[model samples]
Target chain A: MKILLSQSLMAYLSEPWPWYVSGGLIAIIMVLLLFSGKNFGVSATMRAGCSALGAGKINDFFHFDWKKAQGWNLLFIVGALIGGWIASTLLNDPEPLALGSRTAEHIKSLGLSLPKESKEIASGFLPAEFSKPEFVFSFKGILLMVLGGFFVGFGTRYAGGCTSGHAISGLSDLQPASLIAVIGFFIGGIAMTYFLLPLFYKQILFPLINELQNSFPK
Target chain B: MTKAEVISWYRIQEMFLFENFHMYGVIGTAVFLGLISVQLIKRFKAKDIDGNEIKFEPKVFSIPRYLFGGTIFGLGWAMTGACPGPMYTLVGHGYWSMLIVIAAALFGTFVYGIIRKKLPH
Candidate 1:
């Protein structure tokens, strides 16, 4: 009986669930959060973390009773992390992820290419070039990772919540501010992808790519 | 699945660029349904498990704050191809490089905590 149960669990993990299953689960969680009188946001966890670490002494923002008020949010982050790990590992899909042809063309247009050694590109998930230490340690990588992180951190707090909080929870509550914020997010995204990103690639990345290609000659 | 394929879908970068809208549609619909359910319960004045009335209060409106924050957040999203919520998922997918972005984000938050008093509330 135990063996049967384990086999079923393994089978369940191995196959991808329909999109609605996850969507329904999120909806349920959101409903629960609403009834419980708690705001569902991920960025706020950092504030709770700061409060737990005693940042209240320096600023009123972090002065909340984190253990009583914001503790559960921390657990949510942990759960998300654990859930992701389980999904990626135990239930790991044997097949490589598939990419839409349009997306492939779009990425190619951006002058991005995967390393030759990687077989994952055909499957369409993560690019080895982007994930490698050499890429991350490069000047362009540092700019994106470091400066981008700073922007996300400062912006989420300044705007009052991150994507999940504003887009999901705040939108659900029908907050006008969230609507405006979402619009702004889209505009920024469009501007980056169409204008700023291409400009960066042309001015900075192209030169790097050229230099690397010349040096490697493969 | 290949890491690149997973990252693309999870981050939804190409989708956003190409206007696929599948990711947005799913999230928006689910969230909207959740919102409608909450509204329904509130209209009925339903009590939670603890018997407390559910409240949905809109936050204060600050144009400048929203504009600044949203724009910066968008920039970060574009750069990293992941937002705060998805960042954890990226890490869970074994993209350890995401740790760099996460650490930097935490530091940014810490910095904000230090100087928040000087900023407009």
Candidate 2:
């Protein structure tokens, strides 16, 4: 029964429904946001919360107590993470996303070996290597996590919002800065993933993976 | 009733879950409509809370506040996959366990509110 279920589920994931449905739903949300007199900005919600915290009191972060503007925005941020996890695991849904064979080969060329038998790198279950708590807490892993956190925080602020805010909401509103920022974001992402990330992953993260694999019981 | 019963219940529940699954298209259309709606509202002379046009203005924006506030936002976003807009949608889709991130976000906000007095401009 599980086999039959998995097969049909795989077929469904291969369909284009995931992208179409999720994208449409977000568009509906964008319209709702404009109606509410609030702009859809993920980063601004954080600022409002911080200012409400009294950022303006000590160093002039919240000069007017922006807390009053705060409402249900933070709740949205929490939902996205939960949504992504559930989408990957519980739903067992196919995302219809796959790295092409050439791209797969390219990924292998970077020295991070992928499973040869895997039809598509994207569809595979989460790697067992990543499941270990020690891997998450290791020197390189922890540094990656923390540095990733800091860079995202600083970048979102510098760019005025994260990708979704600029790409979805700001673009919807035809905001010029959001356009430029969104372009910069994609450029940055491509550059990091293609060039800098590979070197870092191989030199820094790979050894950590090897060490953790040895320590853990397979 | 029991674990097995709960599993059965979930199976039954799946029958009701809308599986249109048109993820990207739905998101794109919704955003486009939302933008159009905002434009319509503004052009129709809709009175804002302050009776002004719904325009984006930089003069009224505080750079320092924006910078600091944005940092907190980016940090949370990086740690978690979802940002503001997607968060609620996730909840509506029944990812109830996400309440943890929501709680942390709220706590972060509450902490900032408490310290608003000591922060720099």
TM-scores, each model vs. reference? 0.84, 0.58
> lDDT per residue, candidate 2, B5-35, as tens digits?
1111111111112222222244456557657
Q: Which docking class does model 1 fall in?
A: medium
Native contacts kept (model 2) = 0.20
Local lDDT at A194 for model 1: 71
Lowest summed lDDT window (length 10), candidate 1 chain B = B1-10
TM-score computed on alpha carbons, candidate 2: 0.58
| TM-score of chain A, cand. 2 | 0.68
Interface RMSD of each: 3.3, 10.1
RMSD of 2: 10.3
Q: For candidate 1, lDDT tens digit of each residue in A39-68?
A: 678898867776777778977878889888
The residue-level lDDT of candidate 2 at A177 comes to: 60
